[model samples]
Target: MSKKIYSVICGTGKYIPTNIISNEVFLNNHFTDNSGKTFSQSNIEIIEKFEQITTINQRRFADDNLTTSDLGWLAAEDALNSSGIERESLDYIIFAQNFGELRHGNTGVDILPSLAARVKKKLNIVNPNTVAYDLLFGCPGWLQAMIQADYYIKSGEAHNVLVIGADILSRISDPHDRDSMIYADGAGATLLTSQTSNTPTGILTHKTRSDTLEYSEMLFMGDSYLPENGTKKGIYLKMHGRKLYQYALKHVPGAIQDCLNKSGVLLSDIKKVLIHQANGKMDDAILNRLYKLEGDLSVPFDVMPMTISWLGNSSVATIPTLLDLILKNELDGHKIKKGDKIIFASVGAGMNINAMIYQV
Candidate 1:
């Protein structure tokens, strides 16, 4: 009388826009130092360092008119088609996004029904009870959705679940902020369902931690529409880099250890560490602590760096996009294989960290 287990029968799939923006163009034209220093020399250093560290060489961005929803739909289509799960058959869709249009006086949950209805119509589905909703947190939002979907399916409330983690992070980042220079826009989705074995295609073990006291360490607020003044329409995302890194460095390693212990896996058992690409340096530091790698370039030895430079940081979409790239021959030389266990961990606003163990 053991509990029923669920696994991803089909592997992951991804879709990135066709536009490729090189770091050189982004740095030279879009950024300049306070002293008006053009990024000629420093840009090379940044690109070289990124090249030496991760496997990523380039990243994609949606065209000027595309939003997170567009990327979400494309990625979802690829995932559903590749996963062999009919979109119409999906009993639930848990969409996690940190950036999008938020209606005044309403939570994203309120607008989710409409979006779900649209997706159903696009796919020509007729199910009435196939629930859809948005999960908002930050980088950990996607991981949070996965954990919740597991509970729903296991409880017999859902037969099939599509867990999508997406973001248009560039929409929030200060276009002029150098610290936020790497921010990019993208989306990715996954298919999860009930199965009879510990196939390990989906969630193996997941955990979350929050330090509510440090909640305001990072945040976003849109323009005020109040009155006599000319109306300004725009959203702004901010980060306290120093404080965030401090909390992340303090909590993430422990989170990884705890997840590994719970899953009865070891650090060495992980074939590739698909961590959320916040930055080249931050990801490296976390891996250094977790693996006892005594250096700042731990990522060069462990994670995918090329994607970071090429794709910048897609926030919550980072890991899945990287996973997609790896699957699509963008990672080069290294490929995910069956029986391999991959560890994915993410840290973001709300000062939260979530780690999941995935077996391929």
Candidate 2:
């Protein structure tokens, strides 16, 4: 029997931040359209409708003194502490992020050294062979990094990989943009070690798709909705919410289904789904549509676990954070056991969609 090497998650950690910003925080925000025209609806009306759609009631924000790199470093530290793996043994440190390091009130982002490098420095790892780098694949960045790490482990190029997803979306979010309420700050990290076995375990198969022809601008950076804000103004994270929502519902399901097929796994065997928490309703629709494609198979009551309501959409952080919580038994009524089949899927800024079928 031939043995195959797979990347198994040896440790998981998350940083959810201490500052809680509730929906009420936006009550005084003067949300405006791209053209700078204020919405006719009252802030209360807007917030209620936003909550109803995104199901985000509150979210965490990093302390003013912390930057994106700090979040990644903290989560990486936690993962390393839990794994009991010597820091010098790591072969790679991949930091999945988009916004880089934007201070609380600063419009500029600091990414010259790379967040991974910063985290490596923070951990005091001196191995130049570790190869620290950053990946900016939007919200799917973390999962994509995991896929890349899997490749490294399978190719025997790496024995241990540290994948960290961190972002302070609150810093890049335009206060005047209604979508700002959906963004948050958080980080999550995982340590993957190579395991050779006859049985297929850990990451089995994955799929990715990019629809950039027309969907390229679903999520982008643009000037704040407010024409005049007292804070230093520059491009902030913006999205065509309606278009992104529609695109996700249409493509995410098929991408996941394709991944399932690639693994030759039955949809019925998928015990849990840890998907990007971009939006609560959109995720619900994606799950429903996915099952319908498989002959209206009923979704198990706890098939999907979500933390969007409290965590908001922290870009690359969302999926990994959900994963850490589940693995640590921090999420109620959700747990992944050995031999469990799970799906990790994400759709984000590249108009990109990806999914992977994994076993534990």
Candidate 3:
């Protein structure tokens, strides 16, 4: 048979918690360092530089009482409802999270199954092979999960696939570290299936690449980084900012060009570029090369403000979160018409990069 096409038929929902943390609020709240002085006072120049360079304004954090799975459940329901893809129609659910219930027996082992059970119980679709385990690889998990689902749908092993990306940044961020401020808690979902009709714009081709050589560039660790004070503190994320930036600026565009070339699509053919909101600098560099923009591509400079300043860095959730925001707000009453080509590119902690080109 000819190759099958996997269409992202509909994206129904996004779930962000009630509580939001703004940059000003976080700075005041976390002002005091381990030393007596506030961070700005102690490291005046560094804080000032970070303020100018970073653009995230705010990010939502799950209540201390809630877990990553809770966020996932809400997002899952929203996605299923939004797509109108009945629970009975879903054959697989893949949950991706770099930070989830760690105190539990296993990290992501139970996360996927438990979330799957929630849908099964509600929709009453109880089948054995219908579910599979969870997977993790830092921020790239969303695209990685989508690529896997594409394979399953193409091979006819499944009909409907729900790939959810969820995370709790507060759990992974060191309260004392300034970098931690960039992270926020949230979830987004995409429904993937085999496209049998011309009306559906399915994923034409998929490719993912990772350079494990710099595996240690970003990571999380156990109590070694902190003392377990009976509080819920566990692992925290670590990153080499400059080094990672160098690698991403060099590699991500190349990966994107490769994907587009394989699909025989030219750069001019692309419409909206839904890039992973890694950072203003990195994203700017990549998008500039792709569109051949002289300076900034003028691609909604307003959107990255919160992404840069407040929300800190939401590894895998950034792309889908941006997608949700764009669909809800920016794409209205203006540009981004139908049949336009859009590209979703991502670069994350695992030193992983994904560049997917799609039509609107």
Candidate 4:
């Protein structure tokens, strides 16, 4: 009988920019409303409320000279170097991103040369047969890419694949908007290779869903009035936080449960859940709900590893970066061992929600 093929994670890497912006920085800058009036005490309170809700203290911003692909290349290089696989042997490159490249301080997304293709070139891979492409699946893009790569390995269509998630959301944020505090920049990558084994040890089961028909406009980027110049049209990332939060609360738990059920893994078997670093309070609530579903009210304090306190929300890069940090022993008190079960989940634009089960 043919050996059972599994796509296993061999290496992981991440790149966080040097430029840091703290909450105090926003407090120092005067913000005004669209009606040409400065925010009053009520508006000031919103900033404090954001701090309570998101638990984001600070985030990094790419230097003016750096592009989205630049961040991605740095991460990809680290992943490739650690994988011990020759660059020429890579069978595919799957790049997941929301904003391609931020220009004019996040007002535009540059897509002329695809970010994936650029990273492939920057890596100096000489093989023309290695396929490279981009995936736009909101914040869950990286996990989705992994799902795709998992299939390729299982089907014997490829031996190795690189999955990357990176974004410079700080460029496209409206500084005057409170939501600006929630966006940041970074990139993360992982290398998955096929291995013949008697038992499955990689991605066990996964599920992804979209509700764009009803919630398409919940989280998005489009033309909005720049507070600096009321008449000029500028693009910025916008979201109805409450609606998005509600949607996540309602759907994410079901997705995770469905994934667990499909994989035939019990809730007690999961060691950690690496969810997208979107909002701290909301994430905790999602975990609480998931635990309740298992008929347990007690939630482990360390089950979910978080980087949003410093990383903010880098869209697709959040999960991979957090995973890399934990795997490298950079995150305190979190460790993975063989036979450990983990769950990955995220919700983002396109009103997309997804989750996956993996064994380490």
* Candidate 2 Cα misplacement greater than 4 A, ranges: 229-234
Model 4: which ten-residue window has the lowest total lDDT?
Answer: 223-232
lDDT of 4: 0.87
What TM-score would every model get versus the actual structure? 0.81, 0.98, 0.82, 0.95
Rate residue 61 of model 4 by lDDT.
89
lDDT of 2 at 260: 93
Best by TM-score: 2
Candidate 3 wrong stretches, greater than 4 Å: 1-4, 28-48, 102-125, 198-200, 222-234, 292-310, 329-336
C-alpha lDDT score of every prediction, in listed order = 0.67, 0.91, 0.65, 0.87
Candidate order (TM-score): 2, 4, 3, 1
Q: What tens digits encode model 4's per-residue C-alpha lDDT throughout 1-360?
A: 556988899999999999988787787655555444566656457668778989998899888888889999999999998889888999999999987766544445587578889999999999997899999999999999999999999999999999999998887776666767899999999999998888878888999999988899998765443355453464678888889999999999999999999999998888999999999999999999999998875887789999898889999999999989988899987898889999999999999999999999
Residue-level lDDT tens digits of model 3 in 213-320? 755555545322333365344455656666878888888878888888877766666666666665676776677665553232344433222244445566666666
Which ranking of candidates, highest lDDT first?
2, 4, 1, 3
Off by over 4 Å in 1: 1-3, 26-59, 102-117, 198-202, 222-234, 293-306
RMSD of 1: 5.3
lDDT of 1 by residue, 64-136 (tens): 6665666776777888887787767888877787755333222232344444344555656677777877787
With candidate 4 superimposed using the best TM-score fit, by how many Å does residue 44's alpha carbon deviate from the native?
A: 5.8
**Alpha-carbon deviation at 176 in model 3, angstroms:** 1.5
Candidate 1 clashes: the total is 8
